[model samples]
Target: MAYDNTPSFDHLPIPLTSDLVKTEHGQVVFTAVNGAGGLETKVVDLVDGAPGAFAPRTPDVRTVIDRDSFGRELRRRGLDSDGTVWASRAKGRVTAVYNDLSTDLDDAYTRRDDRLMLQFVTDPDWSTFGNVADGQYHGQEEFGDLLDDAGHLIISHQAADLVELADSIRATSSGHFESRIQRSTGSQSVGWSESVEARAGAAGDLEVPKVVVFRVARFEDFPTVDLVCQVRLRVKGGQLLLGLFPRPYEHLLREQWQTVIGELGAEIGRDIYATA
Candidate 1:
């Protein structure tokens, strides 16, 4: 069925490529749409420029072929507006795109989701266990701590070998990795952990060593104390070994702690199976 091919922001002049898209000073701009169906813009700090533009602009178009076609192209290019895709044609090229969530998406997109309830160690100082000389055992301790705190695992042959592990995995790899703070209480008391994970597309059976570092911290409000955790992983040989360290914190309910542990266990299993 044919669909309407009208731009939502008909009132605002269609942004031109030459238009100065305002961004936060020293920040990269990512423009997207909002839930209200308005133009949204976000800015990210520039590190070294990657292989592509930080905020790619869609071609300006006076007309679109059809709604579906436009939407398809926007999604293909990783653009979205208010959960809707933006499509248009400009400069003789059919184009579709979405704005960056930071700029165009609502604050809700930037807000943290709810914390996952799991049983966590009450001691906030549990991160201390990660201290050891750089070695294989150290890598293991780090992995264990990460599994304990957050719900992720890292495998590596040596503690000092994590960068190499990351390099090896990134090379000839077909997936991606994401890092973020998992959960945190608004106050110093009561929160979840931070962690990182790698995802690979199905490809050749590649074996790389794994290594991880875990960091956890605890605060004393007694029952409502906050727990913070961080983990990093690396690949070892043909198999992925993990090093994890968990931070210590209090006030995490048993259910929450169990959930975290479960996630870590599942990730470990996946890591092993993937290597196999």
Candidate 2:
């Protein structure tokens, strides 16, 4: 004879502890486990439960490669040819270093105490609303707005600041630039060097110092699947200045981005320079 059996609730998998709790103020707080194995609590009164809190973390050890080593790897990966990594920026004295996201995503993560920021830099003409009249400016405005929206979301979620250039500026040439330079103080600073250093050190094996810029295109049109372009810029005189151009689709690809970012390490390698 065949017998029928049913699953019991007592045998079902259940969490070890309560996932959420309501405070006297009517705010919902989530429970987490900290290093001490104690309950780490957080306020979850947000639509997305805090924005930047869940950004991917970089690994504690990363592959370390010099410019030459990086170039060889890029060639092996078919991302570059004939030692020409930054061919597009040939006139500019810069080289690119590529990091495979599949293997390198761990190097981008931040710890609980560490602070993260998303900075947006664009050319003055491209950043303004008036330039939207031009055909070339159509998608550019939406892209910038997307970046601004992303920044706002990040700030609201992570309680961080978004820095950008000042609006009013007098320039002699199109290349001349100015930045508003807003930063978080009182235990948080926006100086790029310190942040890079911390991120690089997160993985003891990662030696290359490069700024990873994540560029998203067609932001409004396809928010979910927006293309991401990662690039690194070189720092000169202990300072790195990026030019903002007004092109929506025109962006620095991953390979070129690495080359520009690789240049900054050369500056940091110099013994005479000092970081501000």
Candidate 3:
């Protein structure tokens, strides 16, 4: 015979105690032990039973994160103390520090955040959309060799306001950018869920410090099996936080990151991020 492993419901004499009393307003309340072994008082209000006194109530912690409340909508899935989103797929920090605004177009350069972004946006040969349109890498035997070169391509431009920049990108790019929240879904077996809205669209009325995300599928080697490439722009505290995320490791390679930056820098018609 198989040994039975069923749990026994025998009550232990641990001195369990509870208090039940009726209030002056003809309502009943009971004080008992909560799940955490702490004393708790709760009203046993029900349609069948006696109704407890109606009163206003404050929300608890569990109700905050579990529901689609403001707290749940504004917290990052994974973030550091410095408010930077780290990506292991890229094998380096994707974010960088913001410096003084540049007005000089001739001498501007790319920052670390922008450099990391180029890896996903530019072609394998580190060419921009204009270069590709101009046939810079057309019919070239070196195309395969350049595609294998992994590099960062950072492209950024300043605008008087975030709405203006977003409008410009929407006007130029094929896809229209919209304000939305990135909610985490799926089980742990698939992948842990996370929220990108906390940092991206948390500005509410203040359009200056907002987050904007866009999709980029221009590259040939963009992994179709993995998550799509998403570029996140966080504008806050009078600085811009730019980075690429959710890239699978197989797509990363080495190449010259500056080539694409210089190309876009000329077309953006504004100054680019330069090191101090």
For all candidates, the clash counts are 56, 24, 9
Model number with the top lDDT = 1
In candidate 1, stretches whose alpha carbon ends up further than 4 angstroms from where it belongs are 1-221, 245-276
**Candidate 1 worst ten-residue window by lDDT:** 267-276
Model 3, TM vs. native: 0.16
What does the lDDT read for residue 167 in candidate 1?
A: 49
1-276 per-residue lDDT for model 1 (tens digits) = 999997786556343222234443223545443434555554434533552544433223333333233334433443233222211111112222222244534453422211111112234343343332122322333443433433222232344454443444344332322222123332111111222356432333323322233333321211232333333334343223333333443335344433433443343222111110
lDDT of 2 by residue, 157-193 (tens): 2323222311111111122112223233322111232
Per-model lDDT: 0.32, 0.30, 0.29
Question: For each candidate, C-alpha RMSD in Å?
Answer: 27.6, 28.3, 28.9
Residues 156-263 of candidate 3: C-alpha lDDT, one tens digit per residue: 222233335334333322222233323333101111122354554222221212222222333443321222223344333322333334344233322222333334
How does each model score on TM-score?
Answer: 0.16, 0.17, 0.16
